[model samples]
Target: MPIVDLGSIRGPEGPQGARGLPGLTAVPTDQGLADYIRAGKDSKTGQALDLAPLLDKPTILSNSRRVYTINNGPWGAALGAVRDGIRDARILVVSDSTGQGVGGSSMDSFPQRTSWPSFLAQLMDDLVVPTAHGLGIPKSNSSAQPYDTRWTLGAGWAAGATYVGFGGKQTNYVAAPGSGALVYNDPRVYANTYDIYYAVSNNATYGQLTAVATGGGTNTVQTGSQSVREIRKMTVVAGSASGNNVVQITNSGSAGNVTIVGIEPRLSSQKKVIVGNASVSGSTTSDWVAYHDNTVTNGWNAFSYMSAYQPDLVIIDLGINDAIPSAQASVETYTANIRQLITAAESAGASVVLKSMIPSVAARAAREAQYVAALDSLRYPFVDLFNRYGSYEKTSAEGWMADDVHGNDRIYQDEGRYMLQALIMSPMSLAAKSVTIPALPALPVEGWSERWRADQIPLTVGSDVRAFMSVARTALKPESTWTPPTLAIGDGGRKVVRFNGTTDGLSLAATRTQPHTVVVLGRLRAISTAANNGIVGAGQSAGSRSSLFVSTDGKLVINAGVSLTNPAAVPTTTQVFIGVFNGNNSVAGLTGADTAGAAGSEGATAMYVGRLGNTGMAQLDVEEIIIYPRGLSSAERTSLTAALAALAK
Candidate 1:
């Protein structure tokens, strides 16, 4: 960093107490934003970047209207959280006919065919992780009985009921007082817990009244008058496979417009991985983006609620429909729309993963190129199934294609399983397992090579932490146990190693010279030590020396030869500490803020971590440490600090 002659810009020294930079409490560089979306490792942080939403990373994806955190949350630290048992993962499949599970079995309807999302659910083993949620949307299961009969409309029902049942649009049956009801078959074949979701504006009550001569259950519900179409779920029927009214809603005299959103059935036997397959088969990014603010009662002409499923990670599988248009204008529109959808999903605190779909016709695949490129440019987690599984023709060669556009059950199953598997084997996920500091961009102008990471330390109590990047580098022989703190973010399952402050310490192999940079990702266990607690310091066996340590008064004192004292610099929690020293020019930075000063000839001795010379041993939790043997420029230091911050997974 440059030592500027501020005499030119200086007005006058303010009063007697303030002349230098004021000490700042620890400041996080960014507002905790993740870096990658494609399945890979970020070159900057050397941490995993993913093609799925890693809720743990908590990155940002901002557009014109809002900014969003792509956290794979309500899920877990990684993708396919259900398989990992992080949470019973809620996956909302927002696709088209493929999402409807159409190509499987015979070319029949929604009931007989298993959805493509079901394949993914089966792969995630969601069937075994029972939760209170399940997916059987009314539109998907439109047919009632007699092999082909739709729900029979009763009296007082509007002609629009035809549009709702057959046409899966936001338009619902506007029933007048005591109107025709949606009656099911006698034998409720797939009987489970059925919930009728609706939104009534201007105070309306709807549900089954008394079981008249028609034979239906007697259950009524009163709704409030709300401005927005707030969704409501009423468990209309809970029947058995032994013949019952699947769900007969004899509207309980609703005076106002009772907009029926949709019906969802939760199968008791299949409550593991709650899969909401509301994918609009012939839709694109534009269609889904249009649903950003849309709810069930006023959504697309499909059986999907954009965010109501409460997914931890929204795997947006688009491109085929968007790519179908052969104009460049379509690609730009697609890019904007997809970002809006991502903004919507992220707005709900759900991480988003964009997956590319197959266009089928070889020529249409070319049009998809711009779409894929556009998604890539957006830098969201994008899974290129077309590229990953090879072309449709190739997949068909492997007998996984149902036709030109859709994949067979086998291939679809593979796609589902691989999505989670990709998350499992992603570089981001695996990096948390070991050698976490390898990819951090610490090697600037300094040829310094010594580096060590505490996160990779084996969980075994007494294991020693060694330096990677080079075997000959000094190892930290811990006198304390290996227990990483619960909140160490990016290290995944691994944790920080704690020092008990007694004999717990580590030393550099050789005494360092004048100019060097040191960065430590750690936290102080105890403050208010009488003697300086050396975090990583060098120079003789006593006195101040040149160090980055907690001073006798509990301040984070930084110096090259001349120590600067600031009480607030004391860090009690986790932080990234950076110190640069080169004779009369030294800079100390904690978190994002920094303070620079004149450096004396200190910091030119062997460095010791967790100890000040021989006296003040520190009680600390160490996550990572880096020593670059040269003075870093301001830009490199800033870049390095930002990269380190992204390490919080």
Candidate 2:
């Protein structure tokens, strides 16, 4: 092989070497790479790429094959799942406050602590994403708790969610903390980042019930239910006296013995009550006996026997009893309960409205302050009834309430009105109009007989029309019984008018000559032989026998002249009438006849220009009924009539 130095050869570029077979362009592999990544399997190299990046892309799979490709696929799926979970989430509120006073006295505290859970439930109802269920754990420390739980859970299970007890067995089946049995334990619960647990102080008289949470070897108390997992805040507070005002029954009073029990998250689930004593009185043993009797007979629990019916909003009105003592513990219990109620409702996906406790007396303003502080501290929306209706001092005299605690019907109605206004004004409310109609043009001429038809006024050979006319006539005698003349005229190449009636003794007359509309008038005459009977002077006898007819095509007009030869010969009481009729036989007529010897009449007579029959008729005259393609004004009618008379000549 001879090795020629290429640099030396150079052979004039050798004719571009046939273009080097067009360099093969690189095709995009990103699309293919994307597909492989979406396949969710290891690559040919047996190593799987981190799909986290691909998680940014969403893959739509159909028939086991990838279809649509979306960015951030995994994250989107996670978010969607979260949203759906939130939509289906529910919350259960448990209140353990019992009704009691600081001085061992029974009080009319129902559902002890104002039933804050119920109020919270009502608020939740207004939320965009409503709760699947709102179950109240009633009086977890009372005997009713177990029975209520069993009944409520039984219903809940049938509807789809489980029930979990919060406290011990007597009042509730204490489940392991954070177990799946608890609503919080369910991963779906986190669909929303928030959860709420509600508990209340059982006794406002002796010592307020405080939420206890396990913290590094000891129990701790928190202000709001949002802080701990198992521990929740008290939403409602109630109070009653226990023992001496100074030496209270710390934990044994009706208000002191509070607990929380089971709850169901199923749709339409009812509240469940738990164990607790009723407000006590007299000896401690006697009070305990009465509490037991009440629980056994009436199924009384920690709170009152109240239960919810899945209300959209709940209202809590409590703290009056707690404020009586002016004790810090009582106030704390009230505040804690409110906080818990709010949390539970939010967890359940509901909005809440707390009501401020009304004061009982002017001096009780201090108590009201404590109550207001407790409510405000919760940071939930609230309705201040005390402020709305004048304070106790102003409304108390007016009898706003029947008792010191419960409002009367009037007050309740007022409350209802407020609620209604709030609901309607809220963005979530809806309303609609009842009826509507399109507007139409108003017509002129009231009380005038009207008829509508396809107009043939243009009088074309084929056009149809409906004519409506009114005429009034007076008693008139024709000079002779004669038929009107009919004629035809041509306007350029078009057939303008074609009259087809008789014209024996008829005469054409126009009051004006220069381009005037001619009105044809007929003279009526009665034939009689006897001297006085002959043509009895244009009276009813003559008027009834005459008629005028014309075309609505603006080409014709008719006027009938009636007369009575002797005005005294006809009965003075004799009356005459006139009428006009349209093509459709629709008629309008006048009541009085043209008086005899009128200027237009040759002798004594009466005549009128009016509509004919109420609806149907043809032979009639329409007065002032100008006839011209272009409507004639008063001057034009006069001018046109003159012109026609001249043309007739």
Candidate 3:
């Protein structure tokens, strides 16, 4: 019965079998992005829309995000402090040759222009606004403000350094004779103290050091503790406050026996960001965890004694060399050792970020992949850059690489920028906010300030956002040529529209309500040189305008002329800006600052965001904009401030 002409047993197509639920008709383009794959769920209606995006590349676990927002305790402080103009933010990057930005599988003698650490330091330096008291000392301009100042005295770990006996790129190999001194006239920034890393070649000769004054008034005995070949650090404090930035180190006559390997100078009581790089070529995690046991041939030990010194952040860039086939570490061992490094850093009051191994040569690709994927267990701020970057072959074809193991200047620069954006845009954990918003209940609150809510557009970057919807699901369209602002991802993975200071533009529809209050949640990317940086505006021109802006001297202005400068405010940081228009009684509020004066007109017939005609184009990033039919009461303003402040962070 079963075998009765089965080939001819195909009945009349069986009514198409109900069409089999649309056959998953999603094309490759529907997969969202090439690096990410999409999955859909059944909804009993027509086709189910895209539900979730599953990463299609290598990563430890989905939980190990590009940045660990929650666990980034110290990192968040460092990030926030730097953004807030904190004076003393330091980062220590311990890594192998890749950390040094040396392209090629093997360590090179010179450095490429774009190392992740250098990029990190530069990006951080950009945010630190210069004040009368503080100037950001970055590792960016090396010749102008060098970070790694080595001695040219000895071989071994001191190879990278130059002897300061004669100022300039240390070329002389001789030490100061007798009680004479070798002075390091630091050509960089002015500093009060200096970190001196040295190795003793022969008999000990590390002696007194005096640079506080030219007259040898105050000289202290040096640390002088030296191992056979281990790199040791000695902190030299200024004897007095008013000498030049010259460090005079004296050693008993042992010729070039006492060699200064590295010099990191600290500004006397001044604030700056110094990224100390302690990286050796072709070193691994094992080499780091072991105190003085770095591969002898790989040069200086890139290890820092955390107990004596500390940094705001510690970026551990290992696993690249560990993935070498001959020296391949077990994934478990790699995971455990990485944890060990994290513990040491965190225990020292510093936040840690893990750099996943980059793509390696074909021979070590598989092992490198294992080392990268093993980071899922670390649960720290992980830079899963290897996967986000193109494949080895694809990258090699791009001409951004010198060898399979190292990317050239261009690729390294792009990678560094990519890595930097990942790190800076890390999601801010809710538990870490200084102000906790009194939890709001389901919508339609007692005093609803927002006429529109939940205006979530396509989460994809570069996707056009045509219209935003109100609570009633109706739409508010922008001008014909205008739509979504220049979309970008800001800190905390928040989708925002960033204005490019000079050219970018976007506008919102004119206000519909007569007595309207417009609220904007955003921050300026920088302090504009313009007299005023427009945020939101209405009316025809500057004279007859209802607007909110940042004044030249860092004042937040509302529709009714500039307000009294708030004592407890920073115009550059994120703020909840409110503008109320009601003719003469119109008012504007910025966090705690408020001003009451006459607005050009009421009802806000015309409106714009991140732009004010042509002259006041804003260079800022905006997260959300809400409008209410009328002015917010004092209590409502308080509640809104708390709610918006919580989001601002």
Candidate 4:
């Protein structure tokens, strides 16, 4: 008979198999099994891997723009690029004789009439289609001196610039009483169409110039024409004063507004116009004003004046005078003053570049040190001109300066290039990466125990125990010709000792046994000369030998043989004693009262259990004395002896 095949003989088809539950394969794909393993290993090993250490350095952020310090003279071809806006650079050229070493010479006649500003204007015209305007001198009828409007017109022609001109007197130009006249105002006269009218005359009152349109109907003024509109109705009162300049400007029309966009005075007068300078001197207190009225008075007062015109950037080059020993105090004052000024400029929305003072051999090394110190103390972004221009000794022959102290025009120009490079590399304009500190190693847990051992005491347990045998040999000894006591184990696994040396025929037993590990920790002494034949247990003295026998049941008598014959004759002090560790594991509990058998002793048989009760395991030793508190059971006794045997090893 053929065996039935289960599948072939199936009576009916089984229901469709239920879908199996998804397994670990369904877990998030982003984290694979390897990641889980790594995380687990990290947790078990207690390793905190800092991902931050793997990141790139931190960056410092800044919003400051670039500033270029140009020479006092021509800027050449580069000026065109800057002016043309091809290079969006803010150029600052120092004009005062102090900057040019002209010794109070006028900027126009400095031999380089095509000065840096002129070159800059030309550059602006070539590069930037809309050139910055120039400022013009204020015109007054009394003063016929040429206004030198060329600088103004050049600046304007280079780009739509404005000119800020200073006048000898306060005079207003009007278009012609009622009719708006043609005022041939050259765009070149001002850097832009807007010009600031500055009055330098103290005696002049507000004077006006008017022009009636000759052609009528708002006659247009010719470009670069020197036509003048009539002076407006006003008066002049002569006044003799040091700071008597009154500067104000009105729009071309009575109703038309005169928007004086910018005013940067070329002269260095602290009491009057606000401009950057090495120093300013004037009798009138009002000559100086804080840029944006920051109210910080110092060397910055001069710098702040230039900043007030809303300059995009400022170039601060100082420290020459600061190097003088006579000017040391002044240098410090100047440093603090400049710092405040920098803060003010920053507050007033201008980026400042402080140029470190150049090195000089004027006073030799002392001067250089002072200047260097001042620069080092400054926190603002700065260029090290001293280091860049080579040392005084190194560059002296290369046209460094003829005066030996002040730098020449060429040096200034070279320094300007250095300053430009520094601006590009300054921390203010760069990003600084973040820094990381490594974690420290873990400390050992047993450090406290090591600290204790250094103090000269030894504490130990088990295999780490310290031997006190040396202490006993030096501090205690039997009487003359007495052999040292043999240290050995006692009954019940307790520590004990046998003194076999001569002791004046007197026998003493000392045992150390506590529930915790027993330690023969301190020095022990044997006083064999004492006439006392007594023993102390728990502060009580034992009686005589006749009563010392144990019970038939083997219970050892505590005070059984305690007796004192001729008690008065026997010295009442000496007694057998034993030391035990206190409950807290400290040996401090052994006060004078516990010094066994002294005066006021509670008899030799009264054992002082250290107030810790019988929780302490004990050891008893005698000159072959036996102790059976309750007659140890045969098994218990055997176990005790075995423990003692093990301890002896």
Top candidate by TM-score: 1
Report residue 618 deviation for candidate 2 (angstroms). 99
Q: In model 4, how large is the Cα lDDT of residue 558?
A: 23
**Better lDDT candidate (1, 2):** 1
| Tens digits of per-residue lDDT for model 3, 208-286 | 3333333324444342333223334456676554336555565544333345534566664655666666554555676
Q: Which residue pairs of candidate 3 clash?
A: 150-161, 150-162, 151-161, 151-162, 152-161, 152-162, 152-163, 427-492, 428-492, 514-603
Give Cα-based local distance difference scores for all models: 0.49, 0.26, 0.49, 0.27
Q: How far is candidate 2 from the true structure (C-alpha RMSD, Å)?
A: 38.5
Residues 484-568, candidate 4: write the lDDT tens digits. Answer: 2333433343333332223211112233222111111111122223222222223222222212211223222222223212111
Give TM-scores for every candidate, taking all chains together and pairing residue i with residue i: 0.46, 0.25, 0.44, 0.31
Per-residue lDDT of 1-649 in model 2, one digit per residue for the tens?
1111111111111111121211112221334323433443332224322332323322211122111111012112222222344222222222122121111111233222222232222222221113222333322333321222112221111111111122122333221122222221111111111112323222232112232111212122332221111223222111221111110011222222222332222321221111112221111111112232212112122111211111222344445544544443356555655554433332221334455554556555576676776565554444455555546665567665544544443344344333322322221111121011112122221222221111111112321111111111101111122222111122222211221122122111112211111122121122122212111111233333223322222111222243122111222111111222122221211111111222121111232122111111122211122222121233433444444333223
The TM-score of candidate 3 is: 0.44
Write down the lDDT that model 4 would get.
Answer: 0.27
Give the lDDT of residue 110 in candidate 4: 31
RMSD of each: 24.8, 38.5, 23.2, 39.8
